[model samples]
Target: MYLKLLPFFPGRVCTIQDPLAAAVSFDGTVSTVSDTSCSYSAVQDGYSYNPDSYVYVDFDAHPTVSGFVDRTEHVFKDTGADPVTCPADDIQGCSFGPVTDKPKEINDVGTLALTTQLGSLTFNAILGVNQITTLYTDDTLLIFAPVSKFDELGGLCGEYNGDPADDLTIRDETVTTDAAAFVTDWKTDPNCVSTPARSMLRYHDQTSLCSGVPQETVSGFEGMCQDIISPHMNITDLAKDECLQILCICNDRDIGACEASLEEWFTTLGIVDQRKKDPLDLAIELQSAFL
Candidate 1:
């Protein structure tokens, strides 16, 4: 699933695609920036109050991302978003930017690298055959997975097994068209209320329960808040309706949150914006932000 979707609805659990091709599950919990916070108990339990903005990716698989293999998990928190210190044993595993060590591209073992951008994460897949790029800004996390893993993965992003007919595979390996059931099964924390009282938050209601208000009025760079989807893509009304729940329970529902969410959505959906160009393409051209 796109990390950008996480902050949209509180308490919704999803298993997202990890940079190392593994599935990592997490729940959209409270928003440190909003008053109508959900999953406060879970936050007290030390879970992230804002799950998608900054995260700690627990690579449950091979842990092949270099510098982190020795450690059980690696934190992907952008330095500008949240300053963190690596464990003494795995200091090298923390690749905070602006990284002066590695080049843009290399065939060496995978490494969790952060870009110079204030809030972003970068890492090359094993053998440099794939690249996983993520940016966390404006309270949104945008993920761009490498096409090389096509047909070999499954999760909220859908089963990439080359069959769109079965894109709704749930946690139990069963396929279901019910979106609620799909989300419930992938929750990392059962204590979270995965299901909200309303299926879709209404915009007409000014109450905190109306998540659509923020989405409809979101602002981006230069006051341009249009979603930039790829020309090849077609967004359904159902899809748009489903996404309205993002702001209702966010911790920080201010302009920054709205802008960040919109920015990442535009980036993930694909298109070149005058304010923010495609990050991956820019990384390649500059030859200074990857590897």
Candidate 2:
């Protein structure tokens, strides 16, 4: 955003015409005349008069043109109407001026990243189990949309068919013994049935969700989600079952009595509210915060 201060001529009682049309001359003089007056050399004690105009001294004109120049005049000239008089309070010392460049959009990664990782199969599985009721918050649901390829792949259901040997193939090659055991007995593991497992699964699901989301939305949520989930899973070497367990625990966590804990998590971190902030500003803020 750019701000231009009107030339402050304190104690000078001069009638203000179209300030936008006003231009500064090279010799530190301001002229409210047309462009024709720019080259005029006639000066009497630092003041000049047009062929058929009133006498006025010119003020020093800065070579660098203000962005407000011409714009203000254009509005008045085109409309052929008087400029709206701004109230003193409204025009207080400084006012917001025209924006020079486009603002950046803000995206929510929590919704996007989580949605991608939880592909249709794994996503549906969690929803099917309904063990971590809190994970189904409105914000979470907003983040969860049907992913086409994932839906096609049949997600977790296609990969895990109740057989330890077959399920073992679905696990990442670097999976640890404990992680392998968890996947081998996912059907009967008490921990797998609880919130920690749910959080872990949800976390993995969210990673996939991030990949599928729109770039803008993905940018918003990706970094923060990584920061929050980093301690639980080694993103570089993902272990499917282990990741799933972590997601379950996180998802099942209760953030006090608030149902909109997911949304609150963002707001609490000073993330911009999507509804209130400009999209570009939000994106920039998120990027800056994460960086």
Candidate maximizing lDDT:
1
Give one digit per residue, the lDDT tens place, for model 1 in 210-258.
4334544433211232242323134443223323334333223243443
lDDT of each: 0.31, 0.21
- lDDT score, candidate 2, position 58: 17
What does the lDDT read for residue 163 in candidate 2? Answer: 23
Report per-prediction Cα RMSD to one decimal: 12.9, 31.6
TM-score of candidate 2 to 2 decimals:
0.16
Candidate 2 lDDT tens digits, 1-291: 000111111100111111122221111112222221121111011111111211111122213433111111100000111211111112211122311122211122111111111212111001111011001111121111112212111111111122223211222332222322322322212232221111111212345323444566444344444554344333342222222222222232321211233223323222212212344442233234323
Work out candidate 2's RMSD over C-alphas.
Answer: 31.6
Model 1 Cα shift for residue 91 (angstroms): 15
Query: What's model 2's overall lDDT?
Result: 0.21
Lowest-scoring 10 consecutive residues by lDDT in candidate 1? 35-44
As for candidate 1, its clashing pairs are 1-157, 8-246, 31-251, 32-251, 33-251, 33-252, 34-251, 34-252, 138-260, 151-160
User: How many steric clashes between backbone atoms does each model show?
Assistant: 10, 46
